[model samples]
Target: MKVAVLALQGAFIEHEQVLQRLGVETVEIRQLKDWQQPIDALILPGGESTVQMRLLKELGLYEPIREAILIGMPVLGTCAGMILLSEGRLGTMDIEVRRNAYGRQLGSFHTVDTVKGIGTDVPMTFIRAPYIERVLSDKVEVLSTVDGHIVAARQGNQLATAFHPELDDGTRLHELFLGMVVGRSDKE
Candidate 1:
């Protein structure tokens, strides 16, 4: 199956590499035409949320992508991508995210945590990450936590993690998203 990776900024190439290793076809989405390509899922990689937000609008890609996500295009958001998907905000996930909740670069860290359904020994790399402060709706399901803070969650077609799964050696997160994509297609 094919997936779209938002390549306008951040560690997008890292995500693409992970997807490639998983034997998944990927398309880098930097323009409107890129979004028009057929794909089963989308990945919003770790990055500076504010700059990504501004670029999304300035490049005229904000609305279409937002609408696609709202309508259930399966999406996996890491770090700043999670912040972008929070409700009453740029994207459609029903949660409130505090940007850089873990502080700046020096505050960055790494740990291996159990990601609920994803199992233990999962390598998590947090770089200026943002955690979910609260789930704004009952539909939102918490997936993982680290240091008493919510780090991963899912709501409908959306999956978000405050850590950069792509930066680690684990493929569970990417496999999980690909599963979601396949499950969605099968149902259709």
Candidate 2:
């Protein structure tokens, strides 16, 4: 299965490297033509949320992506990606995310925590991260949190994290997203 990683902005390359390490083929989605490829899943990486949003729209990729996610295409969004998919943007997932909830670049940090369904001590790196402030839909499931702030969550086939798992060497979160992709493909 080929996965599409949004490459307009953020840490798309890091995510691609991690997925490649997992033996998964990934295609970089940088333009509207790239979005035309057959993708089993999508990964939205950490970066400037507003900038990413503008680029997505400028390149005519915003709607297609939102439609894809809304139609149950498995997606994993990290950091700024979380903001992109949260309320007011893609709005594909029923979540309210507070951007820069962890402050600026100076507030960046690393922490080891447990991610539900991915076991314990998962390495998490936060950089100007945005945490889920609240769940707008009952279908949303909280997966992990940091200092009472929602850091990870799942709703339907969408998985979002407030931290950059790709910045670390762990593979559980990527594996979890792959599992979601596989499960979705199986159901189809």
Candidate 3:
């Protein structure tokens, strides 16, 4: 299976490395043309959400990608990507996310937390992360929380996390996303 990692900005390379380690083929999505390729899933890496959104629009990729997600494309959004998916009125996951909810770079931190359905004590690295303020729709499933803050959730084919799972050694979150991709593919 092939996954597309948004390479316009952020920790996209890390996500690619993680996918490669899992023996999954990956393609870097840097332009509108990149979206033309066949991809089993998409990874919106952690980065500055505002900038990513602007770039997405300027590159003429915003609508196509959004339409794909609306049609049930499996997407895993991390950190700023979470904000972009939820906050910029994407409405794909039925979530409400607050950008930089943890403050700025000064507020960045690391913690070992339990990611629901992934097991306990997973390493989570937060760099200017955003938390799910509320799940707007009952269809959204809260996946993990840290210090009472909603940090992860999933709805249908879309998964989102406030923490940068790619910044850590554990690949459980990526594996979980792959599971989502595989599950959807099987149904097709």
Model 1 quality (TM-score): 0.97
RMSD of 1: 0.9
Best by lDDT: 2
Q: How do the residues 1-188 of candidate 3 rate in per-residue lDDT, one tens digit apiece?
A: 99999999999999999999999999999998899989989999998888899999999988999999999899999998898789455667788888888899999999998888799999999998899998888888898999899999998998999999998999999999999999999999
Give per-residue CA lDDT, model 1, range 1-188, as digits (tens): 88999999999999999999999999999988888878788998888888888888888889999988877899999998998898655749889988888889998999998987789899999998899998888999999999888999999889999999999888999999888899899999
Q: Which residues of candidate 1, in runs, are more than 4 Å off?
A: none
Candidate 3: TM-score?
Answer: 0.98
Show the lowest summed lDDT stretch of 10 residues, model 2. Answer: 179-188
**Residue 169's C-alpha lDDT in candidate 2?**
86
Using alpha carbons, what is the TM-score of model 2? Answer: 0.99
Strongest candidate by TM-score = 2
Tell me how far the alpha carbon of residue 131 in candidate 3 is from the true structure, in angstroms, after superposition. Answer: 0.4
lDDT of candidate 3 vs native? 0.91
Ranking by TM-score: 2, 3, 1
